[model samples]
Target: MSSVRIILNFLSGFGVLANIFLLVFYTFIILCHRPKPTDMISCQLTFIHIVLLITGPDIWLWDIFESLNIDNDFKCKTTFYINRMMRSLSICITCLLGVFQAVTISPSSSLLNKFKYKLKKYMISAFLFIWSFNLPFTCHRIIYSGAFTNVSETKQMKATKFCSLFSMNHIIRALILTVATSRDVFLVGLMLATSAYMVIILFRHKRQHKHLHSLSHLKASPEKRATQTILLLVVFFVVMYWVDFIISFTAILLRMYDPVILSIQKFVMNVYPTITPLIQISSDNRIINMLKHMQSLCHHIFKWR
Candidate 1:
């Protein structure tokens, strides 16, 4: 395999494993304790990332499906559609996470304070709405994508090794692009606004902390840490997302898949998902505490032996 393929495979493997670990950890917490609203969101996001990685073209899911003697059109349509859906859900959930955190950290007198009471209710509603919203917008993928036959005379563009996107009429393509772009723009804009608000809130809180306590006495609260982690993830996501978007849009416009560019885009696309779980694992006190508890238990068992 080429170096690019090797790296992409490694990333897919790591992302899948990390996201699975996170999914199980979050599930354990939900079952063992009164789950926080953010816990549900994090769990859902982890699950989405796992789906995204598995269905991702770079992961060779299509090749496996082909080996299974699955119908070409069926394999291409299902894989691409699910991958697109999960990608859409990934952004929506991440944006929601940021907005949710911003509301969570709002001061008692802030306008967003009212949401604290109905956070869980709103979270569920948001999840449903996002799923409903993205499902239709990305349905175009199913219509336009099929197995790649690579006829030199055709307008089909290779989306993956086995799947290609057939050209649509200009008007239909424009409408789909507009709707998808609008959704992405709105979500990304909301993420940015929430992130900026979070930064300001953090700054104000830190200033107050300095006034009320000595530097040595100051310690970050769980909410603050969660907010910081979300902020980092959001910022990183926006960067990676736009880079992926630009490359994809360019490819679509130029009517060329350019293997090297596609490879780079895939790498960029996977970066956020790959790092997301690691960020949560490292920053989340609960995960850290759980690890410590397991370590202590192991030590006790070893000592007893």
Candidate 2:
């Protein structure tokens, strides 16, 4: 395999394993204890990313699907549709994470304070709404994506070895692009707004508390830590999202999908998901404490044996 292929495979493998580990941890917390709404959201994010990575083209899944002898056009349509839907879900859930944190940290007097009580109550409903909202928008992918039979065809954009996007009429393409772009712009804008709100809340909290205590004595609260983590994730995700979006948009506009450019775009697309679990695992004290507790338990059991 070429160096780029090797690197992509390694990254995908690492991302899948990390996400799976994080998902298992969150599942344990949910089933064994009183789960926080954020935990549930994070768990769902991990699961979506897992699907996204697996469905991603030129990865391990292509060989598996090839072995199953599925019809090439059917494979193209199903894979592209699912991948597109997962991407939509990923952004929406990430935005929801920031919004939830913003509400969680809102002061009692703040206008967002009312949402604090409803975080858990409406969590499931919000997820359902997001899924329902994004699901229809991506149905266009199913209609346009099909097997790539000819590289000489300038109108088709090859997404993978088997799957390519067939040309749509100019009017249809423009309408679909507009709808997709609008969805992304709205979600990303909302995500940034929520992150900014969280930053303001955190700043005010620090200013209010700093006067009463020494800087060393002002340990960060769990909410503050969670907010900071989500902020980092939001910033990282936005940067990655825009980079991937530009590559995709340029490809669509030019009606060309160069292999090298596609490879780079795939690399960029997976970066956020790959790094997310690492950020959460390293920064979240809850995960750290849980790890410590498990370690001690294992040591005691081994020693007793």
User: Which has the greatest TM-score?
Assistant: 1
Q: What is the per-residue lDDT of model 1 for residues 1-305, given as tens digits with 9 covering 90 to 100? A: 78988899899999999999999999998998887779999999999999899888847686588689989899889988999999999999999899899999999999999988787677778888889988887888899999889648677988777789998999998898898889899989999999999999999988877767665548787878899999999999999999999999899777777888889888987899999999999999888998999999999999999
Give the backbone clash total of model 1. 0
> Where does model 2 exceed 4 Å of error?
212-216, 298-305
lDDT of 2: 0.87
Compared with the true structure, model 2 gives a TM-score of: 0.93
Clash pairs, candidate 2, are none
| C-alpha positional error of residue 219 in candidate 1 after TM-score superposition, expressed in Å | 1.3
TM-score of each: 0.95, 0.93
